[model samples]
Target: MSANGLPTDRLGGNYFKLFGASTISNLGDGIGIIAYPWLASAVTRNPLLIALVAVVQRLPWLLFSLPAGVITDRYDRRTLMVIANSIRAVLTLGVALIVLGKQGVLPSPDDIDAGAVIGTDGFLYGMVLVATMLMGFAEVIYDNSAQTFMPAIVHKGNLEKANGRLWSIEQVANTFMGPPLGALLLIVAFSVPFFVDAATFVVSAALIALIPATKRSAKQTDLVERRPWQVELKEGFSWLWSHDLLRPMAIILGLLNMLGTLSGATLVLFAQEVLRTEPYEFALLESGGAIGGIIGGWSASRIARKIGSGPSLYLTLLLGGLTTFLIGFARNWIFVWAMFAIFMFFAVLWNVITVSLRQSIIPNELLGRVNSVYRFFAWGMMPIGAALGGLTVVLTDAFASRDIALRMPFFVAGVLSVALFFFAAPKLTTERIEAARTGSG
Candidate 1:
């Protein structure tokens, strides 16, 4: 038995290794969460340009998710994870070098918040865009494969436990530990965080590589005739679309994601201009999510059981709007931090229930493709939302104060989320979810 009183034998050695890799990589992601936006703000103050970086980073979900699903299904998933992280390490290293070369000319983070104007380095900004896009591609592969890879290492019964613990630790590393460290690194130099981020990727890649290969034997591969990519893709899509529950679930998630990015795309600016947060304060603000996520991750299963999956989801949607709307009106960082904590709590609740459901129901062979299609619908809208977020600020700025323009996205997102709750309430019921699970078995 583990310290938590759960049977350690069930989780297995490989799961821990995968867990370690995820934890390390997420810490880097946590650091990048601070570093990337701070770096963007230093490059330019234009809300649209800052939002553009977000759009480009998420664009791969829109453009590459389907193909990546196919790739995940075809390749050895562990190898795919290793290769993706290795590529990210090299790409991040290149970013560190580019930033190092140009750090002498870029405005300091302290200066940017004070309304200092700096001419954008076209080369550096372009590199940032290119690097983000590539990293996003790698992320798509790594994330999809990782999700599919989970069932291979751990039993289906323990998925929620495994995923919950995994996400909890990831949140701790990404939000709690990473952001503060990133803030300190930023104090030293812009290049320092990127270099550290690269190292994390290297370590994560090595850990994943150490896992035993999950490859099918030649006879197993030969037994199933390989179909064309288009056929396989269609099979995945058809299965998801034909399902009454999943089709709507995917659409509702897409809208929710869209609304999320609507406010989040320009949040760095809002923090700088409206909330008046410095790097340390911003890092502190992010830590709020970690606290919420830790609690949520540890308790999501209990919450779902107590309230039912459907009601849990409803709570997520309702709170999403409420928290975002509240955040828009706050002038203080502490208030925003509180809202972030609430927002992340329900966010993790939604993820724990839904992700575990999908993992439990989907056939292992098609899990990669179906999950990809699901994400394509769910995540593809982010770039569109990001673009709209930037446009909201620009258009609102024309008629309103900069502060109000920055706040508009949150108001708009909040309203949309409440509206989404009404639509989703009917489709994603407890009965439907249970019925689907029964039917799958």
Candidate 2:
């Protein structure tokens, strides 16, 4: 529904402001996601090392994620967001300066890579890694708090719409502006987008500071004789494990994540080895999915209503897997590109639906810890999938053609996705969440 049609009584003013601020902050990160990874790939050709860039970036979610959840629960989430964004702004400023140096201050491609940065006598790869790690750390903190906080600001009825809008903004940030801006920034002034990104965070911090934190309910809130931090931390994890409904969903998301990452890692190989495309052209092929992601986010709410959230998840997940397999068999660049685009459309559509469904169904008190638990495994295995995808390429290359090596992962994930549907969906019923949402149980 349009903003005009929705009754003002159902949507709180503070909630809209909070989500709007989030959309802007997320847009900056989206640009960085494209810029940072491609920048790493361009300067360093080593597949394993390039993959390390993604690992170090995501590693924070594994290590600090649990602690971030604890902190989010104990403190003011609005203030926490401001602090996190401020720290990221400082880090982005540092990275931008380094880029500026590369453009002029260093003045020599000779000093670019191995001199002061990586110490390999010439690689800026080390600095790039540091920048990604910093941003990743900031993201972990911001996300943990936001997950918990957003649910508090809005009423139960608008939860799905709120989450869908957040995903939609992210789609624009990551998929829409990230590619063209990242590509153009690299060509014209590599440092420019980094500076602009830093500025966005600074602006986000300023805006977030204006909002007041949510008040906790003393009656319903848990009280512990021991230190609150210790209690809060364990409570989050305990709630997730003990809950019959959430446990299954968490496990399913983790397993699907592994499948998703496996397909993602193999995309490059498919484009380069199977389609015989250059890196730039391959990047374009990948960007087509980003477009699909944007479209998917826009449609998530309507689709969820039509199909119900659970069935929407099943169909999209299965369709994505089948199309991915078809992509592996495509004989030419045009066909492969067509398959990749459709693959992304379905994959992203699945993601938008599943994510909103989970967010809508889960308890707010358990949001941070549950999300962290979900991230710890769901996201924790991403690097492994990437590494394994690379390994499959390597091992397969040793025996078979590069095309076989590249397409192998697609087939594996296709099978996994299908299995997840059969094994998990029948058990995940709408009746399970109704009690939780109604609070009558």
Candidate 3:
């Protein structure tokens, strides 16, 4: 038995189930993540349209995240996970059917090159946009439920280890295995990848359903569901906003996400024009990050123990700045890939620390709502940043060449991340992290 008075075997067993479910779901996400933009690029070459697809997909974070959080706290988390995956499964199959119908009219996936499609059907573009939006909405619910669910399953002291394993497995599946396979599937048939994606979600839902029920806090039984959601929502917001450590972290994370998306929203174009990669090569580019993520996931806990959480955040920002700056000017595919690897390594380390910290600090009953509110600040800026990327291109089109304009967002992202690093590193001291850990902040 562990110190928490549960059998160590049972805890490990349950976490393995959760890890299995998450790994399968993210594996599917990795495939779809590649397929969606690939399909969008096929349907339209306009940078703004591509950005619009990204924007629409992320818009759910702005619209549904807070409410989703409340729903997560109010309902059975496992049930929510099942429902979210089921929604994704159905929607993804729908997209596959659409793609299958266009097999003759659409260019063969293998025949297409990296650059923009010459002309694409308007109807197809609309379908891609709508499908992506719906999938993103489902993802919002699933992710929030999944994150909050972690605390219920794992012992508090093991949060970092559990998180590291989860993050590493997710990265390996999403970036390392999924994308390259997706590119290969695309080579065989455009619709095949989507069908596989749909199947994975179905399997993931089943896996989640198999996880044993976790104990809920006694405090929750007294607070009936009939109470107003707004009251709880306000409590969540207040909790996050008032926390000295979480508030600054959330704000800085929000800015970083926005900046990251500004460049990421137009990555397909950059891969094509700057790196001059083919479909398979483009997928391989992501593998660099996957490799780095594996290392980061394994090392994050140890690094935090050595340097502390505050310094870990600082390191993430510094690495992120270096990544963006190099990618902005990198003409060689090798150079770009190396930079991506470095960036993702640190990104995973940062996630491990931050996620564990939140899981450790928040009261279980409030976890769902507060996690949602935190994401509202951190992720809400993604759509805005995506829009900024497209807008940057449009605004600069007249003054500079298309390639240069497309590259501008990367440079801007780099500059902003570096500036924030300087501002935040000083404010988020080691003392603050230690205070939060002790519940004294």
Candidate 4:
């Protein structure tokens, strides 16, 4: 038993190191959460341009996930994580410098509003696009490697517990602590938060570098032969496609992510215009997700055991539609806040269960490739969704009020989520999951 009376013997030093790095880096992400979107909104109120930033940011996942998987499988996972973060640090610093030079001309955070007619700062906007795309590529590699790296440090039996704890703290940093701080930093200057964000990446990279190298088993070594990239990629793709449960699950997640981006594509505008929120209030909006994520992360295992994995997932899908619809109709930021809290609770629940399930079932040698392929299905749709989301607003604005146009995506996404629940009901079940666990599926 550890100091908190929870088992710690099974979770060694490396797990804590990984946990700390994730937490600190997520703090930077939390800052970016406010800084990035707010910066885009300041540059141009055009919904398409704003959405383009998101599309470009996620484009790499679609383009690079398969190749990134191959790289993860080919290299040392820890070293890959360090290098990815280091690159991100460098790129973020460049953003800070660029923003510093232009801070004099950019609109003050307080003056930026949904109704403001601002000319697009082509130079800054282009830079945001390029930096986000590069960072997205780095994120793909770091994320794929990090997930695969987790299994090597912690015992398999403790995977759920470890993942749960990791996510909880990450949520706290990313949403709870970081956004409010980002809001404050914006008061100082746009570049200040980016500088802090860069520093956090540096710290995270150093921590990851300290983890001792993992020794591969003879079986894993033999399995991870130096094969052609195409062959290895095909192997991972075939494994996931052959699995009945994972195939549909990945597809379902892809649709869900698409729907999420659809509503979220123009969220900063919605918050500014529809909800009439200031920067601090907007940051407060994310706090709801932080709270929900914390609760869901800590309690997911218990919820899964109590309701069964199938029902837990059903709850996520069901609540996802309901909460999204509620947010569509909400005029007050507090109401939106409540919806965010509820929506994130189920979202984190889905992640905890699904991610843990994958880690438990997938073979070690194929973990990186398979997880990347799974993400390819899971995350690849985001850019597409982002594109549709932007188009949805622009097209809707032609016939309807801007407020109505802003709210349309949420309504559409809600209906799609409910329809998806019916489709997913039969495919994913507690029995199938248990059978897969026992190697009998």
Candidate 2: deviation at residue 151, Å?
Answer: 2.1
lDDT of 3 by residue, 74-96 (tens): 88898899999999999999999
Candidate 1 lDDT tens digits, 353-386: 8899899898877888999999999999999999
Question: Candidate 3 — which residues are off by over 4 angstroms?
Answer: 2-11, 109-111, 114-117
What TM-score do all the candidates reach, one by one?
0.96, 0.83, 0.97, 0.97
| Per-residue alpha-carbon lDDT of candidate 2 for residues 228-346, written as tens digits (9 for 90 to 100) | 66667777778777777667766776677767767666454355446765434544554566666656666777876676666766776677678766766777666655665566565
Score residue 425 of candidate 2 by CA lDDT.
78
Clashes of each: 0, 6, 0, 0
TM-score between candidate 2 and the true structure: 0.83
Comparing 1 with 2 on lDDT, the higher-scoring candidate is 1
Worst 10 residues of 4 by lDDT: 1-10
* Lowest lDDT block of 10, candidate 2: 107-116
| lDDT, candidates in the order shown | 0.90, 0.66, 0.86, 0.90
Which pairs clash (backbone N, Cα, C closer than 3 Å) in model 4? none
Candidate 4 off by > 4 Å: 1-9, 219-225
- Residue 408 in model 1: shift from native, Å? 0.5
